[model samples]
Target: MDNNNQTLATNELATLPLGHNWYQKVASNFEIIQSYLNKLDTDEPEANNLKNKFDNMSDKLNIYETNIQAIVNILSDYDVPIAIVDGKVVEIKEGD
Candidate 1:
């Protein structure tokens, strides 16, 4: 049983998904948002509020993406299944 499990893990590792360039696309989008925010009048009542909100959201996104990348890196180094479905990790058994 242990040998079979090891073989199954090896096969699954061989099928790991390739990395996507989604980070580049997301960075480009953030640049566009920053440009729009820069065009706003600094003295406007809502300008500061909008800028603060945008900054907060940008920080959160950075943290989220960084964490996700780290998780992927660690997972790729092990025998765990990298399959994620609907925000849940899917584990495969020997016969499944």
Candidate 2:
């Protein structure tokens, strides 16, 4: 888009009311910023480094989510109540 159109779109986005769906608004804004960054010259070394960092962060997030799910599954296997204390998962005993 031309500079005029880009400015108009940005102005419209700025005018949006941040209320109940504020998270969706912020996510869309991030998408717009990512699109702009993706349009940059890929041959630039700094851009490559930034892309790598983003990739690494994405991978780490995935790993963290997977581990959390695994912990949830393991905890769900037992019928007793469990609690996390001092970074450890312990089963709750009756009348304790």
Candidate 3:
């Protein structure tokens, strides 16, 4: 994935679901959500309602956070997801 890191466009931010699928393999969960919507038949109002809410999840959910004086970097091309910060990577390490 590192090879493609140079190619990940910064113009737009990639989004994960509300929570459960935040860190799933290759956006499989996200694809699942989209696949359902793609098949939505407007004839079915109930399906449309469900699709509507799911579509708005990105904005409704806490997708991004900001802390004072922080360097924000986006993770990509991964099965799962995370925001590495506080001068540490792969979780917090006590000391050297």
Candidate 4:
């Protein structure tokens, strides 16, 4: 998408009322980001500067994905209602 059409989570993701759905969306984004980062790890030199950037970004992303997975686990454990709108989490009805 063009820069103007990009999904700005700080705006749309935050203002919306999605719950577990957001977790799934975030998980998807994290996957895409991780894949690119992995490619960079192999394609680029192992110099300290490049390594540091990849390490920091990848580590933080892993933490974020872990958190998202935790929410997914919770929702699954309870069989909560889940609605993913436009590939993003838009609703989650608990215990339903």
Lowest summed lDDT window (length 10), candidate 3 = 1-10
- Best-first order by TM-score: 2, 1, 4, 3
Worst 10 residues of 2 by lDDT: 1-10
Candidate 3, residues 1-96: lDDT per residue as tens digits?
123223332233355445534444445445655555555653488877879989788555534333311323333233223446663444323341
**lDDT scores for all predictions?**
0.61, 0.65, 0.45, 0.65
Candidate with better TM-score, 3 vs 4: 4
Candidate RMSDs in order: 27.9, 14.4, 25.1, 24.2
Query: Model 3 segments beyond 4 Å from truth?
Result: 1-43, 65-91, 94-96
lDDT of 1 by residue, 2-95 (tens): 1222222234444555585555555555666555556555457687778999999999998986787678668857966564456555665545
Q: Would you estimate the TM-scores of all the predictions?
A: 0.39, 0.40, 0.25, 0.35
Q: How close is candidate 1 to the true structure, as a TM-score?
A: 0.39
Model 1 pairs whose backbones collide: none
* Poorly placed runs, candidate 1 (over 4 Å): 1-43, 83-96
Write down the RMSD of candidate 4 (Cα, Å).
24.2
Using lDDT as the measure, name the better of candidate 3 and candidate 4.
4
User: Per-residue lDDT for 83 in model 2?
Assistant: 55
Per residue, candidate 2 scores C-alpha lDDT tens digits across 22-46 of: 5665666666666666667544888
